[model samples]
Target: MTADTPAPEGVRLQKALANAGVASRRVVEQYIVEGRIRVNGTTVTELGTRIDPENDLIDVDGTAVQLDVSKRYVMLNKPTGVVSTMRDENGRPDLRRFTKDWDERLYNVGRLDAETSGLLILTNDGDLAHVLAHPSFGVTKVYIARVSGTVTAQTIATLTRGIELEDGPIAADKARLLDASRGESLVELTLHSGRNRIVRRMMAAVGHPVTELVRRQFGPLHLGTLPAGKARELTKIERGALLTLARQDSQASPGPEEHSMQENE
Candidate 1:
């Protein structure tokens, strides 16, 4: 509880910048340490320094930092072969392609692998992003995966029990067979952990290699027939619901597995 204390008059400078859509809190903290941030015309290189957003004049690289109270929350039904990042080094398709016309600076809340596709949230509100992405918050994501082999009830039990990967142990919050009776079958899984390629790894570990995977839901948001590669702004109610979930989850005590997932992610 004593880890961080907000200033009586205002919040941390990095938080202010993050809320204003400058960047993530971690990135804003780096900007603070790198001397790129100035408050009231005075350079500040100390982390956790507080500033009055209403009164203090803040700037980044000499440009006046205007507080953007209007933050954006976007939902993208990402398509396969598109990278989750805003920019890619190899010139591959990225989120910027989908969000190019957006005026607000946005970053992905979590990530979907280039081979995986589905509901992806992009937001300029860094605080909300942190909570959703951070494993400790326990915001569940649901995925429907088509695997190469039939998945049985025993496999579902094993998946729910948990599997040990190189990174850490991952357990599904819930699992069910969506379809079966052929060489390929569909399985639905819900989990809170966000380790890289976790669902693929877990399914492959159970002798069912995933052929296709799509995240159908993230916390309270659902893909709901959203076309692949299309982007849409989150409704105010949807945004509020997600924020409430994140806030409630963050206040709970994190398990050891959650800590491991955080480190690995």
Candidate 2:
């Protein structure tokens, strides 16, 4: 094909978008005419546009779209005592109890200790999974912990300022005391570290032991009113937000190879 020729090797844009559940084929055609769709960062108004859905970056109204229909993303409000592993050798409560209904073999992104419960993502999309679970991406997570004793302003300050642990020094991105009583305190903390039991460890390091902990948010996903032990597929908007986060992170921080190429250039 010549430089000016359009490659006739892929499916029509409208059909591909429709099959990906973006919308009906007819609506996708209208979107094309309205210039609301973009492929590979270029707006395409032609209805005859064909795209390789697997390789092309497609966006609708600036929100990244996941065109692979085979990928499944599930949000589970993991209840305390349930292990994050799909299968546990100890035969205790595990994620398989909740995910067995889905046909795709899904695995948890990152993990939550058996004692700590909150938003857990189960997905089969390896690329997105790696982007989220990898510490290099720095996806933030929010947790609310009820700890022993009253949490003073100094304690909150120390958490954000930094603290030393056995593994290494760690700090919360944000910290605040939600409620304080005579013998207990409710504190909210935000951190991007994926350290094992970091919240519990941090609180203990600061002289307050965490009595109970619940993760309320993970990156763009929230556990809003999701009752414990319930699992549901992510909504379209949630998936878009998640994909946008991953895309933005991947773009902002180039891989080692990309950095090397840039240096050479």
Candidate 3:
């Protein structure tokens, strides 16, 4: 937490890029391979190499990189029908469209699918995004889903007990048939898997096709009453917690030549 403290161990370069808000890990890796990333005034192309994020020097496109310390962290009450993606060449409204009123260049932290609604995080801080999105942290997401058919207690048990999806075996930390009758049930699931359409796939595998889905919570973050289509910056405490979480995880899984960055809101 202080300069005197040693740099985080096992900090992956891509992880630092994500934490910097420059781009996703995949995209950043491509940039690295293309010779766009430099560590301490040297071009870096090796993906396997790691560096200390907090203590190392990372340069992208001739610009020095550091943690996005002042980047704006926001909570958006995403409305249904609005996609959470950054860009869609198909001409659909993406998350960036919602930020036209704000000056900061931002990216969605994790995601809420096009059909899903509720708490969506948008931020310029790349490390926060990286730490939050990384599956290694075992981030728990809570979703409230409405299904077409009544979900029996056995179905809930199956979800909680774990089921096999097309990807592989998956399990929700908890589940309940809040309203098993009338073909309307509130199903809650928590898992670390971040595969696309994971929750929907898991439910469909259990004979409970989702009719409507909304993300209610993500880890220590909440949706509260921000209202549909509204965004609010994270509090100082929230931002600090995010950084602390990243530091903790980085320490736990410290890489050899991790990357880092800085941002202005």
Candidate 4:
């Protein structure tokens, strides 16, 4: 088909591959050109190729591709010292150990550092994952931190005003001193920034090193009382709410201060 031609009936081949969790649409197109994908026992190399997923005999690298229509969404109370990855190359504790009971391939939405722990979502729904992970959606995450220094009001102010990090300037949507001790304190932080090790680095930058960190909430999902290393499928109501949030039209420009990132309970 010509470049200007509209796609034929049924879904595009790459979209089918991505929805089946094989890979992203762009990567799947490459696989088609490389003759790694076959539809009804015939190699499909055209970018405009379309197939009825229900009727097509699709295969990838000689393996039959059975689309998993039953998308699974799981919430895991991640424990400290456990990596948020499907596999750990060093043979260290990873998400696989906790998700051993699940038969479907699941991956964490984002990540929490090995030293940090709390609510984490694992799912095979690539569209939902992409929506939630993308910064444009502005999904807020709340973290509670135990710091080694007296978390003064000035520290909280600094965090709110924005601090220059090694990567760039980042500010928390909200920062509050949960509790304070003689030399240490508990601070609750809320932000939509998904920068690497941001909470730890931000606290350290403000001279209050994070001794312990736990993500209290992600978007509408909360850790609640789920024990560490335990997994549970999202309830029907919870799942519906999450999808609604993901589908909402994001603002034209979602600056850190513009969106409301409230604490969950």
Q: Number of the top candidate by lDDT?
A: 2
Query: Which scores greater on TM-score, model 2 or model 3?
Result: 2
Error (Å) of candidate 1 at residue 235 is: 1.2
How much is the lDDT of residue 47 in candidate 1? 89
User: lDDT tens string, model 1, 1-265?
Assistant: 3659753667899889888767899999989889998786689998869887766767776555555457688999999999888999999988898888788889998888889999999989876788888776678899999998888999999999988888677789999998986798899999888677888889999999999999999989999979998999977457657755654566567554454333111
Tens digits of per-residue lDDT for model 2, 14-57: 99999888999999999999999999889999999999988998
Once fitted onto the true fold, the runs of candidate 1 whose alpha carbons sit more than 4 angstroms away are: 1-69, 257-265
Worst 10 residues of 4 by lDDT: 256-265
For candidate 4, the per-residue lDDT at 131 reads 66
TM-scores, in order shown?
0.71, 0.89, 0.68, 0.69
Q: What tens digits encode model 3's per-residue C-alpha lDDT throughout 144-202?
A: 88887878888888888888765577778887666666756778776656667777888
Maximum-TM-score candidate: 2
TM-score of 4: 0.69
lDDT of each: 0.81, 0.87, 0.72, 0.80
Residue 260, model 3: lDDT of 16
Candidate 3 C-alpha RMSD relative to the actual structure: 13.8
Give the range of the ten consecutive residues with the poorest summed lDDT in model 2. 256-265
- Candidate 2: where is the Cα deviation over 4 Å? 1-7, 254-265
User: Candidates ranked by lDDT, best first?
Assistant: 2, 1, 4, 3
Judge candidate 4 against the unseen true structure and give its global Cα lDDT, from 0 to 1.
0.80
**Candidate 1: residue 37 lDDT (0-100):** 83
Question: Which is superior by lDDT, 3 or 4?
Answer: 4
Candidate 2 similarity to native, TM-score: 0.89
